[model samples]
Target: MEDAMQFAPSENPALATYSPEVRQQLFRFVLQLADTSLILGHRLSEWCGHGPILEQDLAMANIALDLLGETRSLYQYAAELEGQGRTEDDLAYLRSATEYRNPLLVEQPNGDFADTVVRQFLFDNFHYHFLKQLVNNADERLAAIAEKSLKEATYHLKWSSEWVIRLGDGTEESHRRVEKSIAELWRFSGELTIPTALEKELQTIGLIPEYADIQASMTAHAERVMEEASLVIPQQVFMLTGGKDGRHTEHLGYILTELQYMQRTYPGMTW
Candidate 1:
């Protein structure tokens, strides 16, 4: 299975036929996917030894690992598509906060446990459907990466869904906390499926799925989960933008400070 999942150069013949403009757009699309996972994974990893319970600590850590692994694979493929000499580390660690294409939702600080869970649930709901559509991407290598990542994403969705239900339907305090978290985080969710110019280009070329289709699927899934959890979906408000275009919130700067510290200090030092 590991060997079968290995990306071969021949898998993406479409790249050879594409114009340079199309190739650059595809590269940006891939980075958007990778950056989201990388930032979210780093956020989750901050909970390593701080989960409310031992089981949760381990679970969060494992999920973080899964996300980071996905980021590595996606970034590696993105680098290859760029056909430059940029390594995955360069893509992952060298970029400034203003250059990251992750949705603002993922880069937001993980507040309380409820806040973290709600954030994960919101993103996981969208991620599951997004990957489902991506599995059929016109780019075979992208599809292959999505196919593998989808398995982990399935587990992630289930885990987050169960937690959201557990918290939302639990005691009065738990319910209130998750509800509050939902309201606070809901604004960021809109950016997840709002198509950017690069994303639109990929959609036009059939290399990526339509944002509207993914948004519909995500909305249905989220509605069902929120219903089961006895939670209400907040009405849409003014949505925040610019994360996809490299403008991020102030929080991302601190995240980058911590995340890139070692790489920046040591340059290329590897164990």
Candidate 2:
């Protein structure tokens, strides 16, 4: 809901030249990125004072802040492209669960500390590589955003990966917990690489990278990290879908309830 345009102008000359269809596709792609980070940040924020240790509590909170910051920037840009006078707040706080475009992986419940870490590890791995490729996107504004976000994504990946290794290589109980987390979350991860129709269009226009390449890189990195952590990568299975199309898991409704309560209760409220 924050105004991220303060950091950078929303205007992009290149975007102005796009045809209506391509412009809409770009808006959808940007919204997907924003929604993913916004939802994940909200999830991580729930662990603020609930982390297993004070250090971890603060770490997760900081990471959540980073994700939210990125979300604000993406939302700001997306709103500008829509050119309907919608602010970041309107796009974020007023949207229904079905209107959201975040993948299911980020919306799943953060079961326990280990579950949170495993989820973060998986998403961070994909995010890091995805942003890496996005940095070279033909859209200059998007590439700039990606260039800035990749730094934070790198740290997020490192932090989550370390926790995954620590827990997996720690006590037997810890290992069991993270292993379970992996199995439960792996099904949701496949959707990360399966580009939406909008994303495919962007890829064709060079506005986005090829999802197949991104998936391959993400898989290799994830497998290597799992091996180092002494954890087994679950076999590929049926991947969950529909989040990108605005269909979401039931968990998203609960998340939106809490997240939208303040805004709905006090319309136009700002810190």
- CA shift of 124, model 1, Å: 0.5
lDDT of 2 at 163: 88
**Tens digits of per-residue lDDT for model 1 on 132-151?**
99899878888888888899
lDDT per residue (tens digit) for residues 113-194 in model 2: 9889988988899899999998987888888888888999999999999989898899999999999898888888888888
Each prediction's Cα lDDT score? 0.88, 0.88
Error of 1 at 131 (Å): 0.3
Give the per-residue Cα lDDT of candidate 2 at 169: 90
State the local distance difference test value for candidate 2: 0.88
